[model samples]
Target: MNPLTRFLSELQEVSLLIWRAFISIFSYPRYYAETIKQMDLIGVGSLPIVLLTGFFTGGVLVLQVFPTLQYYSIQNEAGNSVATSLIRELGPVLSALMVSGRIGAAISAELGSMVVSQQIDAMRALGTDPIRRLVLPRIFSLVVMLPLLTVACDILGLIGGGVVASSIYNQDYHVFATSVRVGISTSDLVSGLIKPLFFGLIIGAVACHKGLSTTGGTAGVGRSTTDAVVIASIWVIIFDFFLSKALQYLLDLGQL
Candidate 1:
């Protein structure tokens, strides 16, 4: 197929996969054990990297922007700027990107391996719906976990920025905290919190779809894993922009 046709086909497949996962949840088919396992693997296992990424990102941002703010004699508002940026954008975007790289690659590789080895086919033969057994749990786990991870990341990012602002810039920590507290509004939280839900669904859908479609052999598994991460990362960024715009519009209308 041509590139355009291939792209459309892949998009349809991803939408169907997401649809199945969502519909499967309403069946009350509990995959509690699998879901919990995924939550632990994708959420708990990802904290260290997420925390580190947030800390350095916020700190570096402060380092870069502090001079500009200081030049304007409004260095005290550095916390406000940093907090707004982190909560409204960096926290969710960075956290999703990190988790996508880690979780997305792993999911694709694992399911691709299953396909190559015919384990998934065997499950089908045994009357198992892989959508329920595999995809639903992953989708649900990601939807729940990404928001929590984003919140944690935002908090750590603020702390890291606070540290840099207080020590390197000689800004008082209490003052920084107060500024951050005042700067973050309900709209910021709503905008930030909502992005992760779509991001998680998109990541899970992309990764799972890629895995289930793997061809060749081990080489194909590698390709699928790489594709899953890159595509999921791209989708996360693309959606983030639109979500930001939509959220801002709704907030401006006082609807959210």
Candidate 2:
């Protein structure tokens, strides 16, 4: 097949998978146990890395921006800049990226393994819909967990930035905290939270699609895992841009 044809074919398959998962979500026999298990795996299991990423990102932002602000005698605004950036963009984007690397790869590998081993087919033969039994739990878990993770990232990022600002720039911690609180608005918070929902959907859908479509053998599993991370990360970034624009427009309309 030509590259465009292949791309279009893959896109259609992914869309159908997403739609099936969506429909299955409202059906009977909801997999609450599996969903909870996935939540723990994708959310609690990911806490440490998310916290570390948020901390370092905030610290690095302050480290890079503080000197410039200091030189301009506007160092006090550092908190505003850090907080605004984190709440508006960095928190959701970085959290999603981190989760995509961790959860996305794992999902792909596990499902790919099941596919190769025929366990997925076995489940289907035993009268289970794999989309409901497997994909729904993951998709639901991601949707629930990602926003919570983003909140954690936003909070930790601000704290990290404040610590760095106070320690390195000799700024008051109280002032930094106050500036952060003042800098972030309701719209910013909402946008940050909203972005993660779409991101989680993208990650779960792409990972599941790659896993279910795996060919070859163990090598195919590895390829699917790698593709899941790369593709999900790229789509997260692409969607983030459009989501941000659409959200900003909606928020602007709300003020009118």
Candidate 3:
């Protein structure tokens, strides 16, 4: 009944839930089809927001950095800073946040509704595992799509930064391209790509769990939806810290 004990209990439950979700993938072919559907729902449905967010994010970064670069007389390094910042961190972080807000909210709401309707219980009575049927597909979909979505974000973000850098910042296009090429490494891009994969998994898992735990009436479903979003967003930021440390360790060890 102590706080620490409760926390440990919750942690154990989460670990078991994750294990069961992973096992469900191989145990059910229908889960794969459901996962593919969730992927499209989460990934493709997020493209508009991701593109808009990525474009403006790049534009804003260019806007912020170019003036600073000019003031410091490092105008030539404008593209270098922009490219490295986008490819290494900003692109994936922002894209995941955007998608998390969009997709995470929806998943929580849908599943919460199922719980409220007792549909989840109905499925259980029919000899189906709810985690395998509902949660695993979403978890798998998110883990698969986030990296691909991050790639799209990285490309669009770079192009947006390039446009502003050349057209407004007066940096040469070729110079910007070369600087980005040299300043951003494969590892830098990989770092950006990696965060979103984990983000997807965490976001999906948290949302689905919250949804499954929803209680009371319609009010509870709404609360669960809000809680899911807030928790998923916070988890993404928290995971980013650990991910950065891990990536830094890898880079230091020349394993990146």
| Candidate number with greatest lDDT | 2
Taking the tens digit of each residue's C-alpha lDDT, what string does model 3 give over 10-127? 5676667788888776764466677788888988988888888778787788888888888988877767787777777877788888878888889889999999999999999999
Predicted candidate 1, C-alpha RMSD:
1.8
For model 2, how big is the CA root-mean-square deviation?
1.8
- Mind giving the per-residue lDDT tens digits that candidate 1 earns over 167-188? 8988899988988888889888
Instruction: Tell me model 3's lDDT, rounded to 2 decimals.
Output: 0.82
Q: Least lDDT summed over 10 consecutive residues: which range in candidate 3? A: 247-256
Alpha carbon lDDT of each predicted model: 0.92, 0.92, 0.82
Worst 10 residues of 2 by lDDT: 247-256
Models sorted by TM-score, best on top: 1, 2, 3
Whichever of 2 and 3 has more lDDT, that candidate is: 2
Which order, best to worst by lDDT?
A: 2, 1, 3
Clash tally, candidates in order: 0, 0, 0
**Which residue segments of model 2 deviate by more than 4 Å?**
253-256
Candidate 2 structure quality by residue, lDDT tens digits, 105-220: 99999999999999999999999999999999998899999999999998899889988998888899988888887787888888888999999999999999999999999999
TM-score per prediction, in order, is 0.97, 0.97, 0.93
C-alpha root-mean-square deviation, each candidate: 1.8, 1.8, 2.2
